[model samples]
Target: MRQPGRQTRRPERRIPQSAAELARVHERALAEAAARSAARDSAAPDDPPFLQPRPEIGDSWERLRRLGLDPDAGAAAVHLGPAEIEHRRRASGLDPLLPILRGTLVEQGEQPPLILAIADADGHILWQEGERGLRRSADRIGFFTGARWVEERVGTNGIAAALRAQRPMQVHSAEHYLRSHHSWTCVAAPVHDPGTGRLIGAINLSGPAHSVRPYLLQLTATAAKLAETELRARRLESLHHLRTLAAPMLARVNGPALVVDAAGWTAAAAGLPPPARLRLPAEGWGSTAVHWLPSLGECAIEPLADGWLVRPVRPQDAVPAVPGGSDGPGADTAGPGAGLLAEQAEGARLRLDLHRAGSPELSVRGAAGSWSHALSPRHAELLLLLATERNGLSAAQLADALFGDPARTVTVRAELSRLRRYLGGLLAHRPYRFAESVLVTVAGPEDPYDLLPTSSAPAVRRLRAGLVGGTVRLPGTPPLPGPRPRPGRLPLPPP
Candidate 1:
């Protein structure tokens, strides 16, 4: 109790200097925040600096609310199945760099360093290694290999911060927006494709809050750069190898000639203005095939040592007419325009109901009547992406949207091949688009947060954020059991 005329004093908030202290600070902050949220009336003052949210954390909090997430709730991180995890590791092209990163960490000592993790641009943790004890602790919070840590999924953290900032960042204690993550600290840096400068993934180090330091952030950033440099060097070496193999072939070809990897990356070119890029169909170049390229028109494709040799075909050349979904060379001339006409004549309709939280479906209607097609989660997202794009998307663009990295064109091609078997002629190539003649309609989510809740693709996440605004019902999750709250505040949804 204060004496007469004496003023009451508030205790000073302490800055955490150790892991235990950080945990204590988080508990205090949680209690204080809960008190503020529970107040019936009175305006809450700004949080003290030590407890105040960082700019990125503040933005992430708003995103979490818009995504219909409860501040009090915790959810396990999404992880890929074992098979899918292996596929992702190969597709990510980061396997080569993993050993280097691990070696650097191992040199730090036998005590074992903080968790060293690598996540694809979509924030999927492709590889995670470090101290075994800490790994077990992290598993409780879903920080294992294959787990996803995108901002929308996990709130503010070093990985998400690095991706957004396109640099290194350290997230410590209450600086993290999610209460569950307040006990740890993380530092991360974005990695990029050396050729295109596109974000590929991120390299991160995480552990107890006391382990965080300025130098760790710098070290992570340097490691990312080194890894990217290694990738660049490898790509250049491949191109050099391609040139050596193509010299004799280029000398023999009479017209425009170019060598491209399986995913259509240019290796060597001569006599042809290097066409932007050419993504071959799933059949690859083992057999003779025709690929309609962006700048080169229709071209006859042939396999090279480690790539393909493409020669633009003149209109006068009497090649077999391009056939729909055919493997023969004749299928080259069946252009997008003709494909669209065929689809229109058939009058196909595609209806997609993606509003259902975890379950999204697509149905196709033709002369024989409509039938629902079973869609794998990836294909479901692919169809949704194509449905949104009226003009269609190039292989690289689609890859970027689907995998959060454009280099995954190989994966995109394989998946689209399966989708083609399902849709048949309704799906057209050239740019991997829906046939213009098809009538496609999608039933969007009533609440933006519900929009593709299962999809963590970067493109989908961006669209979700763009569409979600103000307040929304908890559409991503099941409704609360009790009485409804006010318009803006929604109960936490189950994972």
Candidate 2:
């Protein structure tokens, strides 16, 4: 106990930076980044000021610029049309978290309201709600539902930063790369798929810069975690229900078999060790779907009470292994074995149409049937890059092609994961490429400029040059433009 008039010490917390302080620090950092750019003779005198940017921020800026964004004249908020927005909302699984997020951040009848916006993993804001007045203010900056807030499209903001970091983040005052956004502050966190651990989207809280406090970041982070917890709970409940249904079915089957839920988790298994996990299509196959599962070749699937019943088409293939290595039954399904089975499938064909307006389209012909899905912008670009490579590229090489940064393997991997889901066994890993037996064809406009207009990769540029110059020739198709190269140096034909 303190005695006399002496005051006792109290714990102190780090104070939130005032708007002016944030401006100063950010200005200095941006000036340093700008100075470095000037030293390299890559920056023009009239370039937009970049406040001191974090490394992630700097990388984002570089990618945006390479994508043809103009810092000085930033993009208008681009929103998906109504139908597309609806499609994303249904798929995002973020709807359940909205009430909790809103209740936490918004008061019953608060005077000045803070905006809560939720964006898909690609940074498209699907939902935004707040006070009437604040909503109007948000509208001016395209913070309304449907606006795209990706760093590449808009610049530094919490939604983009959080998505890139795969964690909660805050962007305040002049920390925003775009001058228009400096007057606002935002905190956001990425939401992930509980089963797949894939980023699904982000949730953000935004308001005037003065309203920001250091604790807001933590608040948003906690909210995000709570949301993830909810997802885990929901998944466990689903698995529980699946198990109850599967128990009855499992007892009836004698051969090695398993019952999997819609998302592909093993609900129950008998006479064999279960694989760690599996993935199901967004929609169920009418009565059944057949796939070449890893290690297990040509398995037949029939709709179960809750999920599906998986059994080997060949009775011999379903025999349980002796719980050990190569000599055992499950040996072939271990580790990279599934991929080996995929490689064995023959006569697979992949058709890509680059001439289609907006985004390119992909259709893969497999043993089941032809399945088609529209490619995202990044997917289209990656496929184009890989299509150009005679030998497949390593992850690092693909990263460099997609982002112009070899270090962005995680981002590359995520995009590839989405692509693989659409194509199934048609895609191969190790050095990522189309399957060996896949016959890939790219249909493009006669003019090279019309080919993959959204892609800025150096390889794409070279492809345009080759097509424009007639230096490249497609097998069984007319040659591209430009003067022919000498016989020995001619570009290799597409495989």
Candidate 3:
């Protein structure tokens, strides 16, 4: 669309000399962009390079436009109740680190004191502390504790944007999609679970637009890192306690065995190579039951003081013997060949219960006996795709399927590798899939829209769309059904 020899000017890449001036520039640029967008006109060809919004800001603005959000609408007023807020605070993993965050961000008492808020992954502000005057101002805009700030609810802002992007983010002045938030500047960084890399919440700093500082983004990011470090350290301490308790228990075991914390981190091992972690049953290991562990095969799991003692069942032997020689809590007494005979009669079967979004379950029945493993959201997605395809999915194919980016094969491979640890021989590599000998079935919600409600993957979105339109059906499985109750826990065989 440009004449020959004329090229679009690129925005400057150098750091701005003054934060206040940069905020002013962004405000002007946003005003012009908003005007052009509202008028349905392309950006003026002769606009100055400084008039262009940053790429992320521009993208957010476009998304808001597509969603038909009103730039002039007052800030969203919905907030979680007090009871819900308290529950989230306790579960956010941030409560214990509140003192650290307050020390790092609040007690420093910078001039023009800033407001610090911590929000859960869902963007509900779980805690807020700062200058009294600033807190009062924030309260007017529904930015206090218990308020939801996700982009979908309140338009573009740092806390919601950072959580959505899973990274550090800054919003200054009119860069906010909602005009109601245009007077403020904020920086936020997402905090993730140290063990599972799941997003837990975000650390946010906000103040008047005039208070915008180049260092605030880094400060927030540093606070988030510190919180994660503390969380990891706490987990390590727990593992240490578990190791101390497990040492004596595993010493008395007869064969290959290990002890692991609830999150599956190995604390100790005997007669085997200790994997750093093991995938345990989703609902957690029952104190008196034998479970099928992918890495260890059939395992008799005994509850230790702070961990579990896992002993592998030998194929030649009917049961894994307990330390006391009595068929006790950690003993498998299914009798010789009981599991093998069941496998021979029924073969291997995999049932994916995906009717519930956040609680996906995978049940595997075979020579090792039947057990259900709770699935992470990502794992559930991978299994759904594999179950539907039947022919399997290469890393590249799966990368494209999940992320809409084929170049993300490395991420796909890493996740698949973790899954293989939980699946063992039941899963095959090359093009990843369930082994040919396994029969896979998927149970889904009757309302197609309910399928993986939390997933934003392109493939899943498309499948949901097709299903709602009656153009698609859950392939390689029986017809979708209404919400079904989860099966009761399998009764442990009598001791």
The C-alpha lDDT values of all candidates are 0.62, 0.63, 0.67
Candidate 3: where is the Cα deviation over 4 Å?
A: 1-91, 107-113, 121-123, 148-179, 182-187, 196-199, 208-219, 249-257, 286-288, 311-348, 351-363, 371-388, 392-395, 399-418, 424-470, 473-495
Runs in model 2 lying further than 4 Å from the true structure: 1-52, 80-87, 107-113, 279-290, 295-298, 313-495
* Error in Å for residue 7 of model 2: 47
lDDT of 1: 0.62
- Candidate 2 at 430: error in angstroms? 19
Model 1's TM-score against the true structure: 0.52
Clashes of each: 5, 11, 1
TM for every model, in the order presented, reads 0.52, 0.56, 0.64
RMSD in Å for candidate 1, one decimal? 15.0
User: Candidate 1, residue 64: CA error in Å?
Assistant: 2.1
Name the lDDT value of residue 369 in candidate 2: 39
Better of 1 and 2 by TM-score: 2
Over the stretch 241-314, how does candidate 3's per-residue lDDT look in tens digits? 88888778777878888888776667898887666555455666546577665445667877777677778885
Q: Report the C-alpha lDDT of model 2 over 1-495, residue by residue, as the tens digit.
A: 111101111212235456676676555544544565442245467965433444444444444544556555677658899999999998998888777777766654533458888999888899988778878988877778888997666777889877655557777777676767778988887777665455688889898887766667776777777787788788779888988888877898868788877656667888766764443332335554676453354578888876889876664442222233222211111322223236434686666777743346665555533444444446677787666554678888887665568998997886676455435466778888877787888777655554664344555655655665578654225664557665323343111
Q: What's model 1's lDDT at 414?
A: 72
